[model samples]
Target chain A: MKLINILSEKKEIVLKKWFDKIAASYPVNAPSFLKNQKNQFANPVGYTIEETIEAVLDVLINEGTDKKAQEFLDRFVQVRAVQDFTPSRAVDFLFMLKQLMKDELKDELQEKGMYEEFLLMESRIDRMVLASFESYLKYREKIYELRVNEFKNMAFRLLERANLTFEFKDDDPAFEKDVSDSDNVK
Target chain B: MPNESKSDELKQDELVKIDYKPPKKDWMDTPVHFRHGTYIYPAKAKNLTYLGLPNPREWSPADEDWKLPDNWKDIILNGMKERLDKYRSFKVFMDICVRCGACADKCHFFIGGGDPKNMPVLRAELIRSVYKGNFTAAGKILGRLNGARGLTKDVIKEWFYYFYQCTECRRCSVFCPYGIDTAEITMMGRELLTLLGCNVNWVIEPVANCYRTGNHLGIQPHALKDMFEMLLDDIQDRTGVKIEPTFNRKGAEILFVTPSADYFADPGIYTCMGYLMLFHELGLDYTWSTYASEGGNFGLFTSHEMIKRLNAKIYAEAKRLGVKWIIGGECGHMWRVMHQYMDTMNGPADFLEEPVSPITGTRFENAKSTKMVHITEFTADLIKNNKLKLDPGRNDKLRITFHDSCNPARAMGILEEPRYIIKNVCNNFFEMPENTIREQTFCCAGGAGLGTDEMMEIRMRGGMPRANAVKHVHDKHGVNRLTCMCAIDRATLSTLMEYWVPDVKVTGIHELVANALVMKGEKERVVDIRGEALKEKKGEDNVR
Candidate 1:
């Protein structure tokens, strides 16, 4: 029996554990709300996490790559990034998959003499943590950029009120240049 | 250089809190602070100019001088006088408030952001104070003692800050003893602010887009067609069903108009797919018009006249395409305008008969005057009449909850229609807390053009109330999905839920409907509408 074969057979348990681990990072009350629904709308955050984990597992088992899982991963981490989590704490959920898989499938892997393969899976999880960290940083930067833009727009608005800087309507030719210049208005 | 104190830097997790204090000085003496997350960037000059709005000169909320014309005060005061006589509701609302403070605790912004200005009564006071000082005789005699103060530039700035902060959800109106809707007050305040050329870019840009391209996204007819075609491809790949929807086709019985965001964006696109599949399932004769692509009117956020201008196209396109009536897809403020304001603003839609759901023969008395039916009402009627084949088990994996959008619940009383459809389509449907679900429901925290990215901090803060309720239900009943009928809810609630209630996600009611609808002769369906693979049927996968 191969490691991939065992994973394929017990993917449901693996995915459920993965989803539970990620959801547990939320406040204690939120996990119960997140876990009970098999429905997507009822447990959307959980559903998204479950789908992402499942997609990741499928790619892992088949030795294939899927961009969809990364997209889901971005959403998962982006949410955490905006929360009270620090950078490391935000991306920590990605690493839980390794422990969860090792615990759930340890017996099967050892009995099937697939110890090396388990280590390989650990490396894959390690790589995912890095990817997720990058995503988390990107989201954090975006949030900071937005704050700076708000400040600049406000400063310029006040300047206009003080009759310091000039103002341009959208139709003015200067408007295009002003809006397109260095400041991130969008 | 002086040594910097440790408190000079804000903690990573600590959000800034600006507390309201009773001033030692008079209300008129206090200066305005255009704080981030509370104020919005002013409307671009072109958008205002394109619509021929007054004072189209470029202005920013951050500016010290707004570049107002010398006669600006007179212009606004006269505008108020004209509006007082023209719209009796505005006058009645202005005179009715008794400072009971009942509506203060009712607003979600106050609950989430902890800003006293977010309190409904005070938000109303930002403008009501002006109305008193300028319009009423008591204000003239009593002044600040009687809650009346002269309208200064600071007062105008305060109006821009607080009015834009409101989502116009009307939850406060539900609590007001006199039924003095804060939304009506906010609309009037926003209208007055527009007279100062002080509109937000997020709103005015959408209004300009809707006016010029017949959609809020400024999508051309070719781009709109391409989007629909791309969705068709995705549908084929996911469900193995090829659905061809008619676009701008003449002589169609119904003109189906949805928010342009549905045609272009995620989560909304899935809902759009749901609409296409549901329509195809019913074999409904409807035409999609690129010329009238937007069901939402951002102009509602600007002024009534602008709303009327943006809305005129719906009936005009309906007539041109020879559609007897219109069926609106899921949207929020669009419904508010259609249900409460459309007929009066641009009606006598007498050329079209009352909209009867063709499948169920249910005549929508609520929409009889406008000759428009909401898609949820249409679907609920169909389910009630047993018109379509449904397999609730297809949604067995979902434990869903319905979020009554503020406009539909408060403005249109569309509380039951969506719940009826959700119950029929899914097996595990739970309601949020009693206070948080219906007419008393909290806003998605991002509506009325406050849904922009720059406002994310306030949006998240404002979402706290809705998220708290969702957390309560999610913990108590194990509910995870938050279903809403509004397009803005679908777009913004996803971000809100992700930030506040990390375990919950959002979807449109129609998306779940499409998930459960068992199309005739369809191939084995493996994945749901969002392209998530469904669990294999028991004992079937192994046998295969």
Candidate 2:
């Protein structure tokens, strides 16, 4: 299948699992919480789920192993920073999901001896996302600094390039001597 | 017996002597309308404010401090003198006035207040006296001897108030054999007052603001874009018409124009939306420009130089945009400036092509020759040519009487265009008395810059005559709706209606047209995309 379709299917499964875990933990008003989705969900980021998923799939299209997949996940955090979504908000959302999973699936994970492995995966994802978010912030700050410096340089250059002239006084003795010399020459 | 008879004859002679004594009552003692009377002061006096001056008794030479630069003054004065000399029609009318009172009863103020001084001629004389005092040697010396006052700060203040009251309506001039225009005198007076920095704070402040910002209401470009987006959303909600109000669209076929006031202020924006929707329905290629957006020239309130400066951008923007014709909005002075002075100031624009109605293929003659057209005229022409589908029944209860704005009717002879459109769309259309109907109509008391709360009493007194005539029809024939072509007239008259005659409502002619025009089934009138209609609908629903 296409890389976009595979990514989209993965995103759907992950989102559903995340929501199910939350619902199982917070059972009292889980349905109401799920119904009141934000504008981002209603409008969606791209034309279709596949199109949005394609952006992530591009990083791992020709990957040999899980390293490239991990790298693609790390780049997701960078893309989020460029989109101006808060890194803290993303971290909070991830923590909420982890809490939900702990409450709902802890027993099952322990029985399967997969709890430590899942914890390690979560830690790796957290480090990758944080590093990428910091880089994006630095990039924006550097751009702002460059613009201010360029503007100051331009202003100074404009001042230097402006026309300048000197006015000589007619009453000066030197000016009188020059006039007299010119008249004699003529 | 002979002595008694002699005494009786002496008594009779005493009675005759008593009869000959000069009547004690001067007509001014119980003046019919105190508002219309000129509050005369000493000619040489400083600020003696009768008309809303803050410190009326104080005499300050602060006006002198605000004097124009020498070069600017020279240019302005020379340009004015040249224009005065060049405008042959105005000169002819000014020179030939015989002071006949045929137009005296034509004034709404005179009719309403029963003030003889409110007569258009006597009001014109107030300025004429000053003109004679300053311009001529005989007038300078003899004028003071004959009750003329030298132009002073107080006089300037008075000019600002009274001239603004005149509404530049040429209704009186229509009746005069000489066609003596009060609007010209009002314009001259406003120009002179502006030189003294005596402009109304409300008006001049906005004009200055317009100069600084793109629009008169000081709406910035980014804010305007946001507002348009909001309006577009509203349009979609109301009529399901998904259209964008094109901003700064360069190289459009037509420059879709309206007064900047409409975009910024109420009732105006509603009408603007209507225009936008109509244009959208027709699928016309047009764009709105922030640079040349303002149709109402406040410079027309002050000087010709100001008028020229304000109008300079219009033609330049049109040429830059490569548009064929500029379609002006429902503004009185805008149309007047466009119809009368735009070509004269800008000159024969050879670059623009003539405007043609896209649907009908009927060519608008002299569109390039003339730089602008009044929206009403354009719409009326289209309706007359049977280009638009209109249902008169939609305006079943609307009994509209058109009050021809002074500038368009008297100054530019634009009378029938609005009337034709009104009649076409509205079934219960009524014309006022023949004299008051077309060119001979009275001012709405507050025109020019005179529409102030302080001047309300005077405005009412002036509008009294017009109100009396309107009331006459209202009482007898059930004519409750007062429709006018001028935005200033709408502003002033609507205020008058709210206070003096609450029975009648004043609205723009376009508002009525927009109301009555046939729309597709369940498709709301696209005229007011600002969601004003939704509010009205909520109000109606509440009532129901």
Candidate 3:
């Protein structure tokens, strides 16, 4: 079988192992709750992890370098960004798939001599790790931006009342287009 | 050279360390790590001193030594002992938990952050363990085997970290079979921590502000008047109806109190404007107070005594102003205290008459004891009686959803009333999934004084369930406006939405109401209260 066929056939295998490995990052008793409580509203973190990781594997198994991978990974990263994990540790699980895939696909890979194709798919995950790293930093920056905006907004109307806040004076004609777009009907 | 190469390899190994393996130690034996985003800032000494709380000294969680009182352990024990004796509910909650793990994953913080410690069961165990270790014989004999531990500085540190992490939203209490109030456990944990001069400044400073400057942000009377004057200008400019609000005026028949943020903060100020416009349209005899300027009691987050001290002003101001009944504006915990604790903490309110909506003549039997009606209950009555003409089409440009602020939905059951008002005021109103609304509402995750900017990260994390549910409607129904009654929701959920679902805007329900209300002698409405351009102009919807 082609390496892609093997990957597609073994998709459920890969997702289960990946989900279990990621679920272990939570403390004792939590992994069970995450695995068992399948309701999205009740187990949002688990749901996000489950949903996003599948989307992530789909992007890899189908489109090796899908641009939407980062967006899929962004939902998962939003939970981890504010969590107790370091930036590298937060995205480290993405790299675990190589070992997972190798172990699960060893017989198929050795028989078909598909190590070269395996490396290509592995490199796609490497790029995804980088994408998630970028997402982590992006969310971290968004958090700081949120902090600044929270302070700014706590008194936003008060600032407007005091005339401390004002519209950007039109130095650029292009800004008018953005203004007009906002005026469009929702 | 060989040693330097080894160091480089070790550093690389540490950098690439995969954190998939759970720590081998038990949850209690595992060392605690207080990451930056999870913990709140310590209370300032001045605020503590102002409230005359014990051990008023400057301290930070980062320091090696927390500068605790010498007898901090004894103080906490005694405080716990006193509470266990005084509160039967606390005693029952302490002894009653079967640890069935029913509430284990119910917490938004636990669900989003994935920290087992944030679980309502475990978070309660942080204190319940101490109760076991110190008070129960089985715990003293069995120790760690009995799920109990001694009250040490590390235990205190964990308490401060975990308890403040709770918004005291009581979503957990909704699911517990025994109905253990984990939010009250957090409140008690916070109250005990206050005995050690350990509490967040975000809560304490507001308590002091309530004492010193008459509101949470310390906006003085004249400054509050100035802010209201700005709202008056916006009202006049938008609607061409000139209305003046009476502040601390006597004989107004009703005294209106709201979180100070309503007048001083964004989006909340628009809600404040809505109150003004609605009252002016009915010509209701209501007055705002510079004295009871704050309806939100940050003291509720501090201690019950602090709750009494801070909440005493409203009744005092009510008596002084000679108002008949109190009408609290859109706030979460404020109504929790009003409906649940106010009469007990402050009194029978014998001086004030039962709240009878002047326009609709509907007696608020629910508020007869406290003599304070929620603004939604009052306004829903107004809309019910057809006393106020509404133009729901003015809000046609936006799809809307109501977030039942945790306290109002769970504590007071003010669920349908707010929805009733929202439906009357806006044509497009969708409910979030059943699990995330009504009595099961998710918190804004910034309640109980955790709403400060420094606590932003966890607030966002803990707010995920709420944001996720909203994301459902936002994507499925194209709901862009998340209207809520709580002032904290207005302030914090905006940031939460920006992080999770940036398309959605957090709005106070009344902002929608004022936009739809057909005020008398008003000019052609051109803008909504936030000064946004309106889609359907006055009388344009009628023609359509």
Candidate 4:
């Protein structure tokens, strides 16, 4: 049997381990709130990570590097991207999944002489990691862009009120359009 | 050459290192300097003059001279003396603090910013120290050693920085042994600061606008009608239901008022749609006021006199329109004013009867003095009576949680009303952690007129506690949306949610209610109020 099949069978164990690893990165007080709480309402963030990771794992087993995998991976990576994680740490969760799978499935793969398939799986996860890194960068850049846009909007309102500028009007559709472009006048 | 390379590496390391260096002079000893990313721009001369606020002058917060009146110091001292005598709670809070430090860690701003002054105790101490020197004999003799200091220009600057940073969420009051509310202290501090023209533009401008045009946005009657027309069009496009709401019509039995942001801004506009649909369904005899268009009082951030002046219009309009009672919309500080200060400031409100929901027949005894019911209380009662049909599956796409607006929860204790409304409408719902919700809830970190983006760094820091709590729920419950009642929360928490938990979107509670309302003769629902597609493939994983 292939490593993907074995991995798919033991997906629950692998996912629990992966969830714990990602959650452990938060401050010590954060984990009980993020990991230990079973009530989904009380702990939605923990539940989302588990659900999202499971979906991503299914796509990896069924169809590697496909559109479905990209979609699922984007949802998962975007969470970390907007969090307090540095860029390297944001995508680190993707790489950890491979190590977790290899460690969890070590004996079964060796017994079936599926070690080569396991190596292929590792390379596949590496590709997933690369994709996630790109996704994280895009989301992080969006955050920076949003901060700039917020500043421009705030500056325009303050300046308009102070009568220093008459170029912008509140609630004007045209004013909101390309506010970054309007910064040149300032 | 090796030494030069090592020095270059050291310089690079220093460049990236986050600095938390205390200024060379003690913050208490040093005159508080206005730092960029901390202070707000000054209120305009015209805005101040329009509102009849004191010291109506063109002075920037960043400028060296604020152009204070000649007797500014005396005015502040005498103002404190009058207020201390008038308000027993303010006097008790000023005198009774043991500085136990329990409240220091309780504040979201203190936890997030790590600024010692952001601590509720020290923030109050900024004023208390002056109060001591001016009022007490021991303070006159002991001076700085007894934590009493003479009020000076630097002290006024300190009051401006620290008081505005407070959202008046009252989290600190929850932990204090004597129940000393920092909000009361912050209000008093702001009152004293405003005595010297030390008010921010974000607040004074709104006060002026609300005073003149009946709304903080200064939206005129014609423009207000045009905006409502736009919402009517959007609602028809999304839900195939046309709602006709009356503006400034007399003898309507009820007068509905909301923050001006609801009419003009995103997310809030969606909540306004929720109110319109609900009101239209009931065929309630209510009229919207173009005159008392605002429920939010930014004067709450300015001074008590200004709060009273702006709030007077609500009761004044209600009396003129001959409405039985009022129904206020989703707003945070607005409710704070209405619940705690409005009746005292602008009442007897004896012209209006106790608010009885026309649909549910529930009497809102909590607002008996003010005779105004919060929309959440109105709707929650309606849901309890099975007055409106709801389709929870329409909101299947969202896993939701509620952020209790600090004022509503702490001030009015209207905790369960919004939650009851959310539970009845939406199929998927979650609660934030016990410590971060209800009366113990954290501020959006940008409440009390500090929501401007100029102070993004400090705002982010202040938001960290709430953001951390939000991040917890988002990770645990697959929660994608946060719903709140306050207009400030709707505006500011959006940025906080976007920054820390990007996947989660902030929304007003009524928006969720509207999505699940199941209106009569509505076309097969396809999109939500925002015109975003509702999840079509339901019954896949109900999970509930």
Q: Return the top candidate by TM-score.
A: 3
Give TM per candidate: 0.73, 0.59, 0.94, 0.75
The DockQ assigned to candidate 3 is 0.57
Interface RMSD of each: 14.2, 34.1, 1.7, 9.0
Once model 1 is optimally superposed onto the true structure by TM-score, how far is the C-alpha of residue B43 displaced, in angstroms? 1.0
Task: Kindly give the stretch of ten consecutive residues in candidate 1 chain B with the minimal lDDT sum.
Answer: B15-24
lDDT of candidate 2 over B1-544, digit per residue (tens): 1255566667554533211111234222222211222221111212112212122222222333324233533433444455568666544544455676666655554443333445677666665555456555677789655445564434444444456556666667677776677778667766655444445554554455555564455666666665555545555665666776687788888887677645444345456556766677667788888777677777677667667777777888888888887788877777777877878887677777777766667677745578466677678777877777665655556566777777777777877888888887666777766655566666677766555454555565566545645655776678878887666676677666654456887776666655554444426543333333322321222110
C-alpha local distance difference test of each model:
0.79, 0.56, 0.87, 0.79
Candidate 3 has an lDDT of 0.87
- Give every collision pair in model 2: B108-B465, B108-B466, B109-B462, B111-B465, B112-B464, B112-B465, B274-B527
The C-alpha stretches of model 3 lying farther than 4 A from their native spots are A155-186, B1-19, B540-544
lDDT of 1 at B474: 86
**Interface quality of candidate 2 as DockQ:** 0.00
| Model 3: docking quality category | medium
Report per-candidate DockQ: 0.03, 0.00, 0.57, 0.05
Identify the superior model by lDDT, candidate 2 or candidate 3.
3
The regions of model 1 sitting more than 4 angstroms off are A1-186, B1-30, B536-544
Give the winner by lDDT: 3
Each model's total of backbone clashes? 21, 7, 0, 13
**Runs of candidate 4 exceeding 4 Å displacement:** A1-186, B1-27, B30-33, B537-544
**After TM-score superposition, what is the CA distance of residue B483 in candidate 1 from its true location, in Å?**
0.6
Show the lowest summed lDDT stretch of 10 residues, model 3 chain A. Answer: A162-171
